[model samples]
Target: MNLYNLNPKYRILVTGGAGFIGSNLCESLLANGNTVVCLDNFATGKKSNVTPFLSNKKFTLIDGDIRNLSDCHKACEKVDYVLHQAALGSVPRSMNDPITSNDVNVTGFLNMLVAARDAKVKRFVYAASSSTYGDSKNMPKIEDVIGKPLSPYAITKYVNELYADVFSKTYGLETIGLRYFNVFGRRQDPAGAYAAVIPKFVMQLMNHESPHVNGDGSFSRDFTYIDNVIQMNIKSLVTNNTLAVNTVYNVAYGKRTSLNELLDLLKEYLTEFDLKIGSVKTTYGPIRKGDVPHSLASIEKAKELVGYNPEYNIREGLREAVQWYWNNLK
Candidate 1:
């Protein structure tokens, strides 16, 4: 179902390789016998995430900030491919401090692009957010059609796609952007104020606390798993089709789950371990600013081009996520 036969053959650099998605990518790249150089400043990245890989002979960790062009250049040295995942992510966080968000997401992104171009890397695959589909009533969002951005974070991610396009056209650097929806899995930090909904809810429910739901728990998202994203990233790197090089792809499980349904599923899974979790309630609150009511993705582009067939649905991934939190945090 996946292009698992193709193994990476060159050195790769993963910026923000200590964060949730970044760390997972680093692990996969290294496991496939590629030399991995991980660049992370640990602003939001956890040291524990990368600690397990520290002893691997093929793995190297560079403690550097992507905001600094010199640091970016340093990380790009001798790297054949760049998986750019470094950025301050969270719509609400950007809403509170748009200036900082711009600096990290926009300026830092430009620095990585320039560094990748200067180093003559074969390809640059950067994480694009689904928030870019802002204010659009479109269901099953495709790659081509996008609406105006709703938040500073969305603006920064949309700008990333623009920069990638410009780099591909102007500098001839191969680039691909994966527009990820609500990605969730093990190792995604659930302790922060801006933690993602799934992980946040898992932790709250584990503690027997009523998880809060925004807007009557009607909002939904195309919750994708970590493995599906990793598959898409690997596919983006290994694909030989020239037309698929300089474009974007929607990364999701092709299904949406509402908040209320998600909580019910989580409780159902957790109750297998503890009977009391089944009685936990959910709190409703006003919808937060920069929030969208629903999100779904048309993954046909990815499937037709790169053969990206996601293996995990919300229930499958949520079961694993809840188990991890119970085993690790309980």
Candidate 2:
């Protein structure tokens, strides 16, 4: 799909626009000549992420919390579309603090949906989680078949799908849910206890520190690239296909790589920058709670429905991510 082929400029509202995924979306949208309104509380979002866009006349930054209904309403004003990316995103974080997770992921999500519906936006595309595929040993996860949620975070995301479905039926709001897998790339933070595995490993290996493997290095994930995710979100917004609305799609690379394989790739890439990184060994620990053994995506549904053709695989995406880290973070 050609991202630049979008016909008319749109006024888009991206919640959590100061966060990794949201910031990337904002950059892409602005490059494509669209006006962007970003809503972020800076709780988990960093100001450095959106700092570059501060000078853009087409960009507006709203320092607000998604937990507050007024902030949601304020962000949705005069916006054509809403890409809802705001949420507390770590499984372990949710397991530790279920109340806050529910309040943000579930209640905050509801606030966005209500604001979008009330504002009469053209579409509402929110971030969903692959964690919702809990306990279903399905090799290539499809959209229809989902198991019970394994954690409070997963529970909240699943409830988002339910609420979005209800809103589409009850209020006729156009909605789509992108169930993202282990998405990683440039600007993804490498610090914090809840940092994603790819960035964490890259940061650790860069510092000549041994990164810990949560299991016997057997667990695998469909490590999707941020560019592929951007394609999906843009397609979700501009697609005129009637069948594409009010549904969820798997946003992933449609391939899985084990932690052992992943670590090897990181070392191989980082070693090019510093030979010592190759010698950094890994420390293995017991599997963490609320984690599945494997995750792969059946992106066929997305391919068939929304014309989603992912542009990057694991190695291609990883190499790019490594280069980005080496240039920007190192």
Candidate 3:
């Protein structure tokens, strides 16, 4: 049974729709008979990521940046909903250049919000981050309780939540903020300074090179799969529960996996393709600046409110993702 059947077809606008998560969302929505408009400047997003969708009659690509209010306004024209995913990611990158990060993540976010409000979209769902729980020593992070942001990137995301709340209250715009925890899956880029751990490690192991562990490998995260995130976004879009609107939810698998455990699982999966990969070792490095020691989300609120039932845990997601990289990128 298609769980998304309850929702009516919508003309959705996905900012940063050429990026990893946005591209996946556009693909799913288009598959389900919805019209999708993708707005991207291609700063961090690649044109190749969206090339496959160009022929789709339902997909429209807008070559524009969110930093420009007119561009955001143009993208929001007649759109039913907005899934704002475009932003400069990576704490280290933000630390190095806080100005650009603030411009794209903060100012750009505000532009999207104003556009959505003017367009009168049914709902505005934006990607928040687990880094919002920065510096908090909590084991399982709850949505309501968050620690002060430790980095400029974290600060920008936290500010997004604040802005969303204010917009919902002041402008009567329906909004939902999803604080994603370590999302990884297909189309996730593996070649970048700020590449995510799963794809980065998979690429390294495939090349028979030693993967670098940022810490003792004991640091853990509640890694959520991209499909699960897509589900949450869909649910947020269609949920009739008024309580679910105008609130934030932690989108995660509700389980924690250490970096060491993750590497071991990667080896197990990739070794089936090439047995020599099993012998590849990992090199340890100093802990990264602005990195949280541990992260685990309490998804009780998401489940009770938005009916979020994640379909994949870490191992299941990794199996699918590893196979994707092996077949496509390797």
Residue-by-residue lDDT tens digits, candidate 1, 1-330? 223654556899999999999999989887888889999999999999999999999999999998999999999999999999999999999999999999999999999999999999999999999999998888989888989999999999999999999999999999999999999998999898899998899888888999998889988999999999999998899889887889999999999999888889999999999899999989998999999999999999999888899999888898888888889888
In model 1, how many backbone clashes occur? 0
Steric collisions counted per model: 0, 0, 0
Which consecutive 10 residues in model 1 have the weakest lDDT in total? 1-10
Tell me model 3's lDDT, rounded to 2 decimals: 0.94
Models 1 onward score TM values of 0.98, 0.99, 0.98
Go through the candidates in order and give each one's C-alpha lDDT: 0.92, 0.94, 0.94
- Model 1's TM-score against the true structure: 0.98
lDDT of 1: 0.92
Clashing pairs in 2: none
Q: Which stretches of candidate 1 lie over 4 Å from their true place?
A: 1-3
Pairs that collide, model 3:
none
